[model samples]
Target: MIVKTYQINGMHCMGCVNKVQKAFISHNHISEADVNLKNASVKLQMTNKLQLDELMDVLKNIGDYEMIENESEIHHNKFQLSTYKPLLLVIGFILFVSILSSYKTSFQLMNWMTNFMGGFFIAFSFFKFLDLNGFSNSFATYDIIAKKWKGYGKIYPFIELGLGVAYLLTIHSAITNTICILILTASTIGVIQAVLSKKQIQCACLGTVFNLPMSTVTIIENFTMILMAISSLIFDFFKQIIT
Candidate 1:
């Protein structure tokens, strides 16, 4: 069973709550619907998962009420550590390999960070490439540029791939790191907006293949890349200064 929480507007009293509950529970996959007029929230238990669009459609057909999903609530309830096992494992593997590789000559924090980022981008882009159409559809829902230009979503994976190769090859480090910083900074804006607005949406980090919920973790992932890029660039600047 899956539980989804949504903030309901236009509910003035118990009468409105009852109607909303009846409308939702009448749906095929929905087992129960509890609408709390006092809290302005509705909790739904469903046998099958449904997208926000689908839920909106259901409410639209019933009445003029607006159902705004509480993404933060859903993030807390639906997505657990187990739900993110695949993502965690991928990050763990990348960090392990990158750290191991960095130990070859000497331990350099910059090298380790760059290697981790290179592996992160390459592996993530691989999944996005697996089903480009699917990934683009999901990414467009939350990414700033991707939402504005659908083509950006289509080509984002390729961009990631290019960045990964540049990082791995150590080619044009300054330019590549600058590009990384810019792209991730823009991406983080959209992520922040989505989370703050409590929009229930799936994360496009691992592509549409895995149903990862958009939460603080997504924000952290983007910021991690941005931080690494900035750190490397700063280190380079200091090295030049010292010389």
Candidate 2:
């Protein structure tokens, strides 16, 4: 028997693993199939060397699974721009809209930042709402608070929604920034821990819909929000003093 290892895309949970394994084993040439959800890889013992294209054909009917040659390819793929296109496009669109909203008289830094935050929160929360249970499950794997209380993961999207509305409506700026700072600080802490430990987990920022890997990108995303909140508060403080 020949043994082959391949990296799989779209195997998010044990259920996906089962599906993949079933698909492979059903093929007469593959004798044993081991699917690892954590690393998103599969090892197959086959009677003959199966072509990559042939293996992919087996999975095509089961789901949107793409098989790569090996783990190194998977690692390289992670750093590719296409891997993060969804996230980049989302942030880019938010920034574009925020700038348009703030550019009436001139480029207003405070207004742009506020609008950006509102758009960021609302957009991300919308994805979480798409698959609330999936997002909650993924969040609990790494979030400090979600790890302790599973319900926090379920309610996190709503918290983001509320913050987005508060920012957009320009209601009680002080309280909004304070809450934003506190919440994002907590989130950043969890993200930092996960990145530092090199944990291979899905990022729940865009919810389960986008399968984003937990990395420095997540750290930067959370820190950006926290920095903006702090900056807004500082701007408010100095403005009040000058006035």
Candidate 3:
């Protein structure tokens, strides 16, 4: 009866909590595991043959989350995130600002901003179609929604570009801002999707050049982008009727 309790760490939300759970559930040797985000510990009932080396290997790849044998060393791997998450997050922010910039004093400035946001997204999404392991990989997930909704990954980016173009052509702040905010919201959903799937890989947002860590920065950035996008969406909704 070798009952070993591991000191689990680096869980911030329900998504983080589930990732840890998935890791444990994947293994067959353990009788049961009770993982509490608040407690940050794994209660395992084992038969004394389990090796610590194997356990350590599995924990290291939990995306930004890290596991250490020594409880005191947990901080070393805590909240580590991938670089792509933040990079893509930044790209999303730029698009968001572009919508507001479209509302500048001069109509010419508005046109420039809208074109910038739309054209870039279209180009970026086009190139992204070539990469197999990038954001497109997330679409391969096995959940009901992802499985049922095929080809959806390819539609979102192009749609965003079209919205930008329409807004620019019409010089409609309501439409432009609404579209920008929608993009932001969608990106935030990406973060949620990753968390839910227990995905711990490179975000693949920067086009596969940088191998960054997936840490708390990525999560926080996702949240901030969502907030900004939501504000833009609301303003658009109001502008539509008022103007």
Question: Pick by lDDT: which candidate is best?
Answer: 2
lDDT of each: 0.83, 0.85, 0.53
Q: What is the lDDT of residue 173 in candidate 3?
A: 55
Q: Report how far off residue 126 is in candidate 2 (Å).
A: 0.5
Candidate 3, 1-243: lDDT as tens digits: 224566666778878777777786677555566777777777665322245567766667786665545455334334544424546565666667666565655545335444555555554555545543333434333222334565655565566556646644655556556666665555556556655654443433333334333344545754653454455556557867799
TM-score of each: 0.72, 0.72, 0.42
Query: Higher lDDT: candidate 2 or 3?
Result: 2
lDDT by residue (tens digit), candidate 1, 93-191: 999999889776789778888888889999999999987877877777778898899999899999999999999988888999999998888888988
Q: Which ranges in model 2 have alpha carbons more than 4 Å from their true place? A: 1-74
Clashes of each: 0, 0, 8
**Clash list (residue pairs), candidate 2:** none
Write the residue-wise lDDT of candidate 2 on 146-194 in tens digits. 8899999899999999999999998999999999898788788888998
